[model samples]
Target: MRIDARRRAGLRAGGVAAAAVLALTLAAPATAGDATDHGRGGQDRTYSFTVMGTSDLHGNALNWDYFKDAEYDDSAHNDVGLAKISTLVDQVRADRGARNTLLVDAGDTIQGTSLAYYYAKVAPITEGGEHPMAAAMNAIGYDAAALGNHEFNYGIPLLRTFEKQLDFPLLGANATSVRTGRPAFAPYVIETLHPRGGKPVRVGILGLTNPGVAIWDKANVEGQMQFGGLVETAKRYVPEMRRKGADVVIVSAHSGADTSSSYGDTLPFPENAATLVAEQVPGIDAILVGHAHQEIAERVVTNTATGRPVVLSEPLRWGMRLSVFDVDLSFHRGRWSVEGVDAQVLNANTVPEDPQIVELLADEQATVVDYVNSVIGTSTEAMSAATARYEDTAALDFINHVQAQAVQAELTGADAALPVLSIAAPFNREAAIPAGEVSVRDVAGLYIYDNTLLGIKLTGAQVKAYLEKSAEYFKPVTAAGTYPASALTNAPTATAPNGTPDYNYDVMRGLDAPLTYDVDLGQPVGSRITGLAYDGVPVGDAQEFVIAINNYRQSGGGNFPGVTTAPVLVNRQVEIRQLLIDWVTAQQVIDPATFTATNPDWRLTWMGEPLTVTP
Candidate 1:
């Protein structure tokens, strides 16, 4: 069996290939006696292989919730994490026989939750350190993996370090180097499957990622790496893989299968184009998708060229689900041809937690719990972000307050005199700060992303235009019929998957006229934000000012206009969460009365009519 990998480019069967295949002998991950012994006839006998995948595992290593600091179990009796799924993985591998099973992940593995943050931010991985997330997967023995957008969140060095620590190849066909225009990582990988007694078959697994990474991780990936459209890249690579003699091809797309182009035909390339890959790229047998966090159990798109059906599956985020693909092959005309292909998703809630995985990361888990438990500051009032989605909540206010204040502290002399504004979004609706001791966890929850503060200079008209683009988050209320406030916010549809995530919508805090959302929803978009002003004075197109934004938004993550059209003042490579932690640690008290003194600068009301604040 040949294991094709990296720039070495050819599968000459590495030195350890013979011994490696021995470990996957029939039933090794699971007991040998329990496996489903498949196959019945002779001569023209049929062989089968199973491909299991997980995606968007945002660092949920154990069935443990860092928020609750306890074992996680939802009302549906479902628990999450690769730990629980390990048991299911073992069972599936055993049932199908290890040699015939290939385990892979669709990406977004290293950065999420307090535990993951603790590793990436708190305790840096040294030369021989035990990275808990990588350790967990190494124990599970993944065959090949893909790189998700979040992988670049910790910067290039850390991502590359994590890559070196991995036992498998991190594939990303679209992640190209800016300088050379070549694959920065292994574009695709080949996992050779040795059937029960027949010859070995090569499975070509191609990895594609969302092009939005160029905007989302602009700070880390700007000059270093570039991402191309998924469809075009696949169109370029799939045919090449076929020429290299792959029996079956599987795509591990870190992009959603949805064909939505959120930039509205404006940004020429498609970001979430896994469906386009299946439809446009030929010779692919199956696709495993992620990044949208939707559950795609099984979907078959007819190939535009071959007319053959390509099966696609997406396991939801946070290790809550797993996608399994089974392919039956038969030797005919002296070649192994894919006879049938089936795919389905399995929930992690259905199985018990793998005690072995729990044990493997127990020490690291305990350390993270202790780190989050350590007090950072105190609050005089409980600030809840839950209502921030609908109303002005202190939780969201605290972040805006932090950003405006942080930027203010850094500015000096005449440049600082320019009217300063801040743009913030409510990341976690459930994030709160208790009116007592605040821990590292509380601050982390308040600012969920690792985005840094960026100062952009824009005129009043440009800012208004930016807000107008953001106002598009609301579905236009034609002939208004008592539209609920919740309906006034983002409701992601197929056409606009990148629509306003609660955290992506920009809320300005410097415009003086309380930029009310007296939205003319009955009218078209770009006419929502009104009553704009600065320092109680009417503001118009000529007014110029500086505004603080995160790197994500500054780089146009939500397709918001401004960064590309506005002037960039500075990008202080400081993580906002750390600044929040520092601010709280220095202040020692988060008094709502002190921080929540400013009146809301924005509100949602109907144009030429009044909209009630229900609460």
Candidate 2:
């Protein structure tokens, strides 16, 4: 994150030259309907090209849902996996002419689905096996890809293996080494396009990653790789790219276009700052955004520096959509000038799965399917996370129970005597474990994130503050009444103006006894927690306890209070999802009675009165 003084001086000097370059590269008026416009006369100086982009692939190789052990489909009829995306890509290539098109990704490539887990932990690609993502993307012929925060999930060695398997470069302009403060990956790549009768067009692709990687992946990147702000980083790199003779600059940003931060001021830079980069940085024509998992066809931001329009687009996650950016350039006096930029998203469900990607990943897909389907244990009763967010559920309690037990078993000295508590979130509402049998996928679905376990010490007062912070997930109610789950959940706040995600609403539970509290929706966010107690007694401010938490939360994720500076009681570096799987495999039976509290663990209230909720 340290800025080099010499580099700043060079960037300032380059900015003067970059302004001259922009003056020569004039923007010609063109409509979105126009694919290409030959010169004013018979000259072929006008060029039209396409950039196809995908983000947050997360190791979905085919249109198969390993959790359900069936083809992936939803009520929206959306299709997932790279196989479907490949078909869409081929269609775009055919229509736009393959030579005039380029394909790239916005990262989060290595960890999401059960297939990704199988490769990272079950059958690691580091041991000479080809990663399915690498094989699929290589075959698809990608030009370049940006580094995502999730790329550091399994650690650096595994990421390096996946990077080497790729046919193209993996770029990260702001990802620098802590020891050297130099770029760890290629900042950008220049691709030359040859027209029929005009000079070749040099297109610069700059990749910028999210700054939250410094907090979310602190375990993997701490003291090794540091991420810098996108706006500042782009200011330094764009001029250099222009100096390299790049006529048009396209940014593949692995950050959301919104100017928001989920981490709540934990870092100096915002988590989602793609729009900031486009507005503040000059010489950027367009940006391909990622990480928000939303579909944005086209958004134009006028640059503050040059008053020029910068287009941006984002595809839906898990290969459900593909973003296609159409760029038109005009050649004048032997120089290529940007004419216009347009973008749109294509639904992956509209096309059939690409047979090549499906066949290439057949072996790996089969291996993961078999592994996830293998029965690990039997559940005495059905459990679902459908209502875990608005009401207490046994499904989320199961995660906390397993997490707490693991930490308690490993505690030593003074930590062993301290009472143990566990925190969990309803990551997936559809996650369910049916009665009679449970498999690895059943447990995996409960904890969708790839977070490791950590035991951090906190006082009773700190625990209450933590619960109060989580209470922000619920909207305030003026009076007690029956409310719909959707109406009360995901309350909007300054930090989470779009509403808080389920993964950030943590529910804490005691290991030996229920950690009970009331979420008084009638009160404001910070004062919503009430009747806090542990072991059937009121919790005292001085009372200390060891709480089992995910590395994401303990490492400053969600911007929770006191946890970042809390003393570490234990650090097993074990994935919580794997711990759930191993616990099921060893116990051979998942009984809710063993973990579920006899009384209601927590309840929703409005002005000291219990409130009713409906699904």
Which residue window of length 10 is worst by lDDT in model 2?
17-26
State which candidate has the highest TM-score: 2
Model 1 is weakest, by summed lDDT over 10 consecutive residues, at 15-24
Residue-wise C-alpha lDDT for candidate 2, range 8-64, written one tens digit per residue: 234334442112122111122222223244656644467888888999897788998
Error of 2 at 500 (Å): 15
Model 2 lDDT vs. the true structure? 0.85
lDDT (10s digit) by residue, model 1, range 1-615: 112233221221232211111112222332221212234443454678889999988889998877567787676776789898798898887677666778889988887667777778778774357678888887887777888988887888888778776667778888888998878887777666666556567788888877867765677898999888888888888877777767889999988888764333434677578888889888999999988778999999999998999999999888898899999887654567888899999999889888988999989989989987799789988888776765666776678778877776666666577777777787877788888889977877788675777676788888788888766776665453465667677856454775556765667776222333344566577777777777667677988777888877875687777675566555544578777886887888888766563676566656655445332
TM-score of each: 0.73, 0.75
Q: Which regions of candidate 2 deviate over 4 angstroms?
A: 1-44, 377-394, 402-437, 445-508, 517-531, 540-579, 582-615
lDDT of each: 0.74, 0.85
Positional deviation of residue 346's Cα in model 1 after best superposition, in angstroms: 0.3
Off by over 4 Å in 1: 1-43, 73-77, 261-268, 378-394, 403-436, 444-508, 511-532, 539-615
